[model samples]
Target chain A: MAASTLRYGRLRVVSAVAVIGFLLTSCGGSSDASDEVRVSAASSLSLAFAALGSAFEALNPGVDVVLNIGGSSLLREQILEGAPVDVYASASTDTMAPIVDGGLSDGNATVFVRGFLAIAVPAGNPAHVTGLDDFGNEELLIGLCDVVVPCGAYARQVMSRAGVEPAVDTNEPNVRSLLTKIEAGELDAGIVYMTDVRSASGGVEGIEIPDAVNVAADYPIAVIVEGPNTVGGRAFVDFVMSGVGQEILAGFGFVTP
Target chain B: MSRAQSSHGPSRPPIAFVVLAAIAVVFFLLPLIGLLARTPWSDLVSLLASEVVADALVLSAIASFAAVTISTVVGVPLAWVLARVDFRGRALVRGLVLLPLVLPPVVGGAALLFALGRRGVVGEPLYEATGLVLPFSIWGVVIAVTFVSMPFLVLTVEGALRNVDVRFEGAAASLGAGGWTVFRRVTLPMIGPSLAAGMVLTWARAIGEFGATVTFAGNLAGETQTLPLAVFVALETNRDTATALSLLMVAISLTVLVLLRDRWLRPQ
Candidate 1:
């Protein structure tokens, strides 16, 4: 048994070496010789940041801006794992707290924009969803973001305050996923950011949550102190907080800082 | 085979082989060790007893068992046709059957949504007529798990079916036995070990199925949220809860593999 185990162990080693060699070789020639600034942002900023990245590149000829977007908490986790991100922009300060404490950020994080929650449904409101109260109606197929994210946290708070424990079909990982499911008609309705509804435009209809129960999501951005390109990272952060950038965000229905 | 492997007789092992082997072991085992070292051992029991863990565990077991059963009933016939029947495009069909083995599970889930979701191509028509939707339901979880893990059962059973000698069936037919009798008494016994092995593998894969299930069925507690989905969500908020849930999965998977290793891998 010992001898057989040893043989299998050696076989595993052979395969492991093959995989490692393949990975190392696949890192082929770097695509950008120019200084590349990597920004890890929330999925909510996908459209907004794509515009910002292009404007930054057009201004700085020798530098390229790369945007990586996903759920805020997941992005923060990647940064904590030493991801080579120069700038970390999250939908909420809650997700950015750990990185700041770890001293990975250049300084205090900045709140750049705030997103409001909305009841997102298919165009024409086939589900006939009207107010936040419908979120508790078991007959409606509802989706919400998980509590780990800014949207999800706000979603839960709003639902609880409205005295409605929603019968959630799923807790999506990100705002974009919730929007996609809603657009696909897989979900009758989902609680997502107003900006997401604005981004999707014709694909979805946003029912504004009443001010009495509506939640405001604060977005935070910071430059990573240990990023590969600190100068480029700082530049990107400044550009995002710029008036021009704020206007671009406002066009997407984001409340500016 | 044992004698062949024991042949240290011809050449000495290379030094680089030993060095790389040690590195491989460390690379694979370090994360496991780290997880164990940082475990809130004192709180593990309480964490396991929580309502969320219980709900997820029950849901996972029910969905996985259903998936394995469905895979066995549906997959065995497909495996038989692929292995024993000679037809045009047989190789292409075989490759297609094994597609899920390599496809990313998340992509598989999205594809399922495109096909089975309410607004999906086929799903829209089906929903309009039958008022039945698959996503965000227990059935959706079962479908996603079955889609990804059934390939394991099919490929294994197909290999077993191909290897069994045909003469045994012919010899049995020469006697008074009918087709069903011959198959039940001969073909089945011949592939018993592989069948058992396939079911065990299928069960393990279904239980651990995550990405596809999350994507297709979603992450709703007591509905689509299985153990893996539960662990993932917990990982964001409560590390201790996530670790405890992960430990449950690791322990279950390890026990299954350890207890059935010989049955699955031993020579027939």
Candidate 2:
């Protein structure tokens, strides 16, 4: 019985893998050269960049668009470690500095859009959180992104500006994970990107940051100098900097840089 | 008999076999060598002195010790039950105890979160009544380590219990020794080496545990962030701290294994 149960478990995992592979294969072209563009962007750009990717794909039918979105620091490290990426879009100039300093980027990077931090709480605001000051309340459970990530860096700056040393319950690796906890109501509040609030739909509600205490995040985009598909990389970067891309980003609550 | 043949003398192996074995050793040693080679020896003292490294090392020791202690207290009785008691659903209970051995630590952590997090099934009511939360706290780290490492001790002691001659336990019983007395005297002495071995195994696993601890406890400095979590977060922004923590972990774990190997691992 145990052996048969183990076999059944293995069979389920195998079938799950097959289904995932089939879905991925159906997503886009399996061709080479300018046929595909692999863009690695920060998590904040997920919705905005994905929109641009679809629009760019619509414009250029033969070329496929693949995006790898994650924390800026992690994405930058992947690039440094020679990940197969064509375009590099980061949440901060500091994060992009490594690529440019290493001569791995093609010339100067273009500032695309800016992001700002906001306190996100679960819908209905059960915690009755007001602002940054409320974050310091001992009774509330709060989350902040780890300092290494861009969102966390901005949140730290904001906290210092506000002169509030709030006790944190969890230091999530990235904004997405913290956002997940907040939306699930596990945390009373979390500091995340304004775009994250917009993308959360009704699951989470965003509490605006006062302009005086808020920090503006600088986002930079560059084409990889050592890329296998330089032309595709430049085109993707161009598309992201284009008017349509800016509009799409604005629709996602990103400020025009 | 086959093992006795190998222990007879230091015999020469085939050239191909020697070459392959050398390559395997080098393959494993290469990464450790690289870590050592990149050590900023000049700043080692200052790097270790930093609050991040200091707090992480202290927390790792405390959490792992707590995990080992708790696992011994709870797991010894469990091993005895699984080994000696022939009860209904015994196999199922045994399987559940050993499940963590095969399950991924991260998945184990996720299950822990669902069962013990503030909004968790049992956790929700517990917190409502008592105002206790587990995740993102020091106790959470201990719980995570214990959850993943308890199996090491349980399995080791269970194996030892099953191998012991039942006549010894029966002899103690016939001599008017109570159940608890027999367990503390005859049964325990019969498995002395196994108990020591189990404790060491639990300590080793508990100290090295990372995935479940991070996932369940959530990394927060001076709270839930143990050495592994500290090394991980440090790796992103501070290479020096990461290397220092890594070197410390390797040195400490190696010392433990070396110190324990002869004491408890030797065969009778």
Per-model DockQ against the true two-chain complex:
0.37, 0.22
Task: Tell me the tens digit of each residue's lDDT in model 2 across B142-167.
Answer: 99999988877777777777777778
- Give the per-residue lDDT of model 1 (tens digit) for A1-257: 43343334333433443464346335445454439999999999999999999989999997888888998988887888798889999998889999999999998899999988889998878888988878888888899999888889989989998999898889987888788788877888888888889889688988988888988889999999988898999988889899988988898889986
Weakest 10 consecutive residues of candidate 1 chain B by summed lDDT: B1-10
The lDDT leader among the candidates is 1
Pairs clashing within candidate 1: none
> Where does model 1 exceed 4 Å of error?
A1-34, B1-24, B125-130
Cand. 2 TM to true fold: 0.82
lDDT of 1 by residue, B1-268 (tens): 2534443443767899989999988997898897898789999899899888898999999988998899999888888888788999999987787666656778888888999999899888999999999999999999999998887777777776766777788899999889889879987777766676677778888998887898899888888889999988887778888888988998888787766865454442
Error of 2 at B117 (Å): 2.1
For candidate 1, what is the interface RMSD? Answer: 7.6
Q: List the TM-score for candidate 1's chain B.
A: 0.87
